[model samples]
Target: MARSIFPFLLLFLFTYYYTGVQSHEEGYVTAEISNKGLEFLKDLLIEKAESSLVPLELPKIEKSVKIPIIGSVQMVLSNITIEKIHVTSSTVKTGDTGILIDVSGATANLSMNWKYSYSTWLLPISVSDKGSATVQVEGLDIGLTLSLNTLQGSLKLSLLECGCYVNNISIKLNGGASWLYQRLIDAFEGKISSSVEDAVSKKLKEAIPKLDSVLQSLPKEVSVTDIAELNVTFVDEPELSGSSLDLQINGLFYAKNEVAHSKHYHKMLKASDSCNEADKMVKISLHENVLKSASSVYFEANKMHWMVDEVPDQSLLNTAGWRFIVPQLYKKYPNRDMNLNLSVSSPPIIEVENQRISAIIPLDFVIDILDADELIPVACISMVISSSGSAEISGHALAGNLKLNDFTMSLKWSNIGDFHMHLIQTVMSTMLKTVILPFANLKLSKGLQLPVFHGYELQYAQILCTDSWIVICSDVAPVEQLRLV
Candidate 1:
């Protein structure tokens, strides 16, 4: 009669224990990476630009002029070298349309050799000259319009301002006659200025595509394990500010083989009001649904198990009431002749309520009695356990500490002849408090973490839990050694 009523008793206890507990619906997560945390990106851009835009060379320039007194005047300039280019100031603006990068107060220095010859038709006299000149450019302004191409996973840069002014010019006439000095200087300046503008413009256009290619090659999806992959998709147009840029991302966290085959598209970036002073550098908000989904995945994968087979001390057996129920058995067999296995009987159910996270995990516990000849199954118990906990940021990962608040158990089957049923319950409860629950807490403490960025580190992180989601905000800064991806 007791065995027949066991299932109903177990159900009643579980229902009564979880009667007022709340449940949450599963969903996705949204992350907002603020601009204040993006200072390192500006420095990186400047460094890459300086190293790439150097030793710029222009092809030989030739011009012919028909003069009345000196007929068929021909001029040629060759071997032009732009040795130095510097960017003094930079500004980035974000709007609904796209991002605008304004680089101003730039400077460049150029040097080239020139040659000219003219022949007089009537006098039959010919004159030739050669000279070298240095050109200094200042107040250079360059503006670029940046946009993301979602299909290709790349950034596109277009010229907004491609202009500069001549700060100073020095001319050294090696062989040109004194009478033609002024005329030669005027001609050289015109040709060199036009050539320099075109060369710089062309280089800027070429470099951006290469940069896009490099960014595209970076892995978009991070594999957490064989069973899970986190798809980090940029869901909206990026925003740029004075100190940093913000990217709106949606993480499509799913189990392996569960991802959609169709391509995912991002919404266009809409302009937002300026950020507040208290805004941190890196901000990420995860919806409660994400965690709920992960729990389901873990349950489906059958990965939740807490097992203990170590030999228990004689004291523990005695305190657990095992000696009282089976004194003769313990006297004949050692404490090492026992093993315990606990596995999830059903998927763990997680919910957030009362400013805390809670979970109800159904468990199956099997106890085996080991003999010198063979191992014999002694008892099987079914348990439903509940825990409540809070989450904290430990290093780069989120750690959780859960306390086992309540549980209900019932005997499924038992082979221990003449053993008191209440004694088994006492032993199971003792083992749960001493061994099983602590191991579960240890596993929960490891928690989950975000992927690390190569050149940046996170600090002063704050976590906030709301009705819909959890938000993590942090300040990001450059490390001493920048690791390029």
Candidate 2:
């Protein structure tokens, strides 16, 4: 009984292994956006803050006081203007809660006009003062929290030091003294501190959302061609590291209506702590199913064709005619004009085996002969060409060179004689190797380029080939002309 069951066990093992391989091949393509690469964005945010946070106007602060010497005094401060605001350092992070932006060591120059009145209850006296003072803020700290809307946020601000130098001061007293000017300066500094904090906070709350709008407006879809479109979808919330932010995105690439519907395993993505240790700024993984889907789409399009317009040499035609037992035919038409055309018989079949990608292309060849200034089709040949190659990441594109492995030809119809069948087969095989394969490689190289980011360029790309997928990893850095909009 044990011997009889041995065949069944072997069959079961084979089935299990085959199914496992198939399941692994039908997986998702993932892209990782690393943190170190996000530093460029931080710099951009700081620059934007410097330009947009300007001409800030503060609220009016009014108070009534009873002074020992100057009784029944009323003071009003308005028209506070802050300018030349500059952010020296900033830190941005993403977490489970939301996004946090902390700015430190900010400085700005401020100028404001102030007016005050003094009235003594013992005498009929009214004193008024009007002047403009300029102040220098040494260190300011701003903390902001941003939600997804980019348009909603809260800002907290504090100032470490503020010094005001009286640029111009004018005092008017109806019947009192000119010594009150110094007291006004001291009081102004005490009250202006709180006003400065409130102004900065309000300005930041307004500016943060505008920054978010700019970030959201960045282009997401990269168009490779009319038929092929790559959709980058963010699958999970971004995580923040000390130096960078990590984003998990789906690399959904398809040829119109050819996108395969598959379940996304977003839970598989884990928060990375050492994002700075990553060598590449971006990583794109492509599953084998993507190739299969694209191949099917190309086959359905049926647009693969090549035409050779040059006339065949008479000597070569004669040599072919002699082999076909039609020597006198070449003499009758020694200078016959002939051209060759090739069309796909069906869609190409792509397969991945043992770390190599291969394609089986079926083609039809038509040879037209010019007679009496009219082209007449003389021969039709059907053939299959098998090619295999290894893929590599070249610059920002997936590039590969296909080597023709096997060529086979059969004559479907030939008015040029049966022996000439061998000649046509030889010519077609040469064309496949020399002309057609190179053309296909060129198209593949140009068509598979990675999408370009606004300021970053791909560098030192590494490609990984696996049993079911290919992974491309590359570093992206700012170009010399990099600009943030």
**lDDT (Cα atoms) of all candidates against the true structure:** 0.57, 0.54
- Candidate 2 regions with alpha-carbon error over 4 angstroms: 1-29, 121-125, 145-221, 232-277, 288-298, 310-335, 350-358, 371-380, 388-402, 410-426, 437-456, 459-470, 481-485
Q: Candidate 1, residues 1-485: lDDT per residue as tens digits?
A: 11211221122111111000011211144444455433345557766787688889987889887777667878887888888888888876655445566778788887777788877866676788877766677766766676643432223343444444444454444445635654755666666777777887788778877877766676555555566555554444445554445544344445677762222322222322222335786556554444555555556676555445543443453223366766644654556356566677776776555346677888887766766776666668788888766766576555665577888877787665454657766766776677655654566566554335665665556665555445556766554432331
Colliding residue pairs in candidate 1: 27-289, 37-281
Candidate with maximal TM-score = 1
Q: How accurate is candidate 1 locally (lDDT)?
A: 0.57
TM-score of each: 0.72, 0.66
Q: On residues 1-485, what C-alpha lDDT tens digit does candidate 2 reach at each position?
A: 11221221121111111100012212244545555444555677678767776777777778777789767677776777777777777776655545566777777777766667887766686878766666677667777655432111111122222222222222222223325555655565656666677776766666655655555555333343355444444444444445444443333445654543443422222222222236666665555544554444444555356556632334433234333444434554565755566777876675555457666878787766667888777668788888776766555454555678997888787776654557656765665565555655554455344445565566666655555555556666565432331
Q: Which ten residues in a row have the lowest lDDT in candidate 2?
A: 13-22
Cα lDDT of model 2 overall?
0.54
State the number of backbone clashes in model 1.
2
Error of 2 at 271 (Å): 16
